[model samples]
Target: MVRYLAGFPTPFASPANAIPANYAPNYQYLANPSEAGSLIWTLNMELTPIYAIAPEGPYANLIYDRLINALAGQLLQRPIPENFAGGINGDAYQQARTTFSNNFVSRVSIPGYLTGKTVTLFSGQVVPVITPQLRGLYAWHTEILVENAIATAPEEDIARLTDALTGFLDRIFFDLRNFGTSSADRALNYAATNAFQTASVLRQATGQGMQLDTIDVDRSPFCRMDSDCWDVRITFFDPENNRRARRVYRFTIDVSDAMPVTVGDVRSWPIS
Candidate 1:
């Protein structure tokens, strides 16, 4: 992740448009409240995909190109060139963009899919208002994981239970995600958990509402250490208006069919 630091007129000055099929966060100021300078805004251009994409797809370069162009726009923004009239800032931005563009055009690894770091790009501005440097070109090691829940009952019975529970959760999050008001007893997933008196983010989401994407069984690869665990993720969202508000309901159930059953806790993972 590139940490860009700039003092803008308003937080809204930075463009909010982004690359497609990727996750983009809102322009936010520095984490420290006291250290937040005037109109400090950050633009996190994430290149990773929400779903899998082949390396050389037809639309692969579309987002990458747009991102480079956006960076060029930022580079050409005022305070930068004014401070670096000697020409170092322009040269560095062009070089980084060139390297990124070359890798992109050659069908090499897309820079967007790589892991990002939370760096302080402009530690202390000196001659130039802001100093931007490209870092990290490490090979990515993505883990493919999927876990299946243990079924003590017959296949038909398990399917019915999963379906019923899925519907119950869909309705539950409708209220929780929207109003931020839910009791432990009212939630089916939370009730299933051994020790959730419902004091969790699971019951604390603030948004209009979220749609239920999928509640089916997951069969992805699993961690050997957690072989006894059953995994289910509930994906939901208000796609058009709040893509960043996409959420997931994740839970690990201990295979009850085994000698000792272990059912884990309930939680929510915000994909946005």
Candidate 2:
């Protein structure tokens, strides 16, 4: 199951129209507060699952299933992109939309039944019967809100916002790397103990250092999941030599359960 975590704005509340004039644009000069200010905009995502199949036997099936589940859990528990700019209205927003569009088109184009196929019944009669196929894609969407805070400068405010957003994306990438390494290591260790001679080859083939190429998450109101969850898809790539390798795998993670909380240094106190 895919899980998405939405971002939260600071100060808990926001101004109706614009920020206050006294608000400093620089992070260094901004007052330290714990409560949110004003409501800004929200960010959301979409998630889909990717499956890999091994070329061997029943063991291959087992490994494949385990890997898929591992990836799902890893993505759900990891941090996702929190930057609102990188989301809907951000520079990379259009690209994400296009990617999702293509995904849907591809899924819909798949043939449900082969027209020219014939089948033989148990009664020894041959008939042209429609063979239903289940070749389809799985996808989901989520949304998150970000409270807008007044700042001294627009540029400075955007920069700070993006920084916070990138933090979530970075966390996801970090967790993915860790997950891949652990999975590969476990597979290698098992092979070493069970297969002995082939362990070295397997270990070398599935080692780390593989780079993830693309990560695309849908960024539209249509892709939202209520006030706080969204869907996302992340693509992974492998390196063959000094150059880039062919596209290897793709995974989608749906984040929902996690709630957004502002990060700052102000504590709430009661009037004495």
Query: Which structure among the candidates has the greatest TM-score?
Result: 1
In candidate 2, stretches whose alpha carbon ends up further than 4 angstroms from where it belongs are 1-208, 218-231, 240-272
How far in Å is the alpha carbon of 177 misplaced in model 1?
Answer: 25
Q: Which 10 consecutive residues of model 2 have the lowest summed lDDT? A: 35-44
Cα lDDT of model 1 by residue, 94-131, tens digit: 45334433222211111223123232335442121221
Give each model's whole-structure lDDT: 0.33, 0.27
Model 2 local distance difference test score = 0.27
Evaluated at residue 37, the lDDT of candidate 1 is 30
Model 1: pairs clashing at backbone N, Cα or C within 3 Å? 1-116, 1-117, 146-220, 146-221, 254-262
Error of 1 at 240 (Å): 6.4
For model 2, how does the per-residue alpha-carbon lDDT over 134-220 read when each residue is reduced to its tens digit?
222122211111112212225534444433323323434243222111222222222112222222221222343333344333322
What's the lDDT of the predicted structure labeled candidate 1?
0.33
